[model samples]
Target: MSRAKSPFSPAAVLRGALVPMLVVALWQGLSMSGLINPVVLPSPVAVVERWWAYLLPPDPYDPAQGSWFLWALSGEMLFDAWSSLYRVVLGFAVGAGLALPLGLAMGGKPRIYALMDPLLQILRPIPPIAYIPLAILWFGLGNAPAVFLIAIGAFFPVLMNTIAGVRHVDGIYLRAARNLGVGRTTMFIRVILPAATPYILAGARIGIGTAFIVVIVSEMIAVNSGLGFRILEAREFMWSDKIIAGMFTIGLLGLAIDIGMNRLNNHLLRWHRGLEN
Candidate 1:
């Protein structure tokens, strides 16, 4: 039997690293060649150095120097990261919590679909960023507005995916369940939900990416602390290295979240994979 390839294998690791390594090399070359102004776009090395300094603990030897580092740190990188993470989690939870049930109901019942679909269709096309002013007005300048924006970003993707998943459940499964005299609740719980899980998960993955994007945008305006806020603050000061560091931090965090979501998807869809195999 052929063994499953491990992502951690050296070959896989090398393949993954090649493009990123090449890009960095090109970036460094451009920086060194003085084609681009350092003030406009800092070198990757400078960004890395800034990130390292941002992560370091304050020096105890000279409190004044430590204060300078602390000021530059802007409440520490980890704290800002955690703040962004918390908003994403909370907002995503609220969005998914509402969307899942509503989607299921709409998908299962034509009446529900007819009643809601028109309004949802109209609203879905509106960008989450468009809601920023209203969100701030409604929730004021704090976590509330950021969370609201993130929820708005997450809601539509999840809702659409869930509805599609449920609607697309194979007709054969419904026939089989009905043939067995299964009640509506049992049929839905045992057959429809399982069949739709993969689609729901797919939607969730998309929603999470949207959540991250919305959270960052919201943080830039709605809240005073987060990676987005840091990036914006750096921009105001013309600190290109710090801005790049913050951008990289957000990228790394998004990568971590995507990896986690993939693991969850694998765990949940093992049965589906077995059937396909």
Candidate 2:
């Protein structure tokens, strides 16, 4: 018998942190020794200082300069993050809400699947970035274009995954439901949906990642306020530390979202012990 893996074990946690800790130490040493130009590759300390400045008031004695606008940086960070979050959630909800039912119908009905599969196949290959110009022209920039781009990015993943899930459900389950005199609506609600939960959540996880990616790209070109826009703006000012800080912010937020989603998926799918592992 094979032993199960526990990824959250103490050994695993230490092993994961070791590399990053070493890297941070190496980075600090290099900057202090002047082996690397701070402008070119800002130290880990510098990046944290810049990030801290963004989240809190800057002291006059701080080397970065300026007394700061009370809560300007934090406000911008929160506002931009909120703006991106709103667009992604709204678009994702819209896309998945529509895709789930359609996907279920398609999987349950071969006639519908045959009719729709070809079209989906053709459209699915088209990248979301390709639609940016048209989105701008049609939606005219700002939140509308951003949301549209995110929706396009997220739609197909959920649709395909949901269809796969429903279609792959065990035949015995369907027969058992019918044999039990379960009504069509009750069958779908109690049996089909629950059976397909794994696949749907898988799709949702993929869709949210795509949504975040598209929202970032959309913000860079179509909107003025977001982590993406902030990164580009920092580049224009040649603020390397600030730019790196912004990148870290985006990465941390993405990681947090992914972790939260994973936890939720695990909680809901506790019966599927393999997934939790």
- Model 1: lowest-lDDT 10 consecutive positions: 57-66
lDDT of 2 by residue, 1-277 (tens): 3553666899888888999999999888989998887788898988998987765534343436544444354456666677778888998988888899999999888999999999999999999999999999999978898888888888989999999999888989999999999998998889998899999999999999999999889989988988888888888988899899988888887998899899999998998757724
Candidate 2 residue runs with Cα over 4 Å from true position: 1-14, 57-74
TM-score of 1: 0.88
Q: Candidate 1 overall Cα lDDT vs. reference?
A: 0.91
For candidate 2, the TM-score is 0.87
The digit string of per-residue lDDT tens for model 1 on 1-277 reads: 3554977999999999999999999999999999899999789999899999876654434555556645544447888898999999999999999999999999999999999999999999999999999998899999999998899889999999999999999999999999999999999899999999999999999999999999999999988889999999999999999998999899999999999998888888987754232
Residue 166 Cα positional deviation in candidate 1, in Å, after optimal superposition: 1.2
Best by lDDT: 1
TM-score of each: 0.88, 0.87
Model 1 steric clash pairs: none
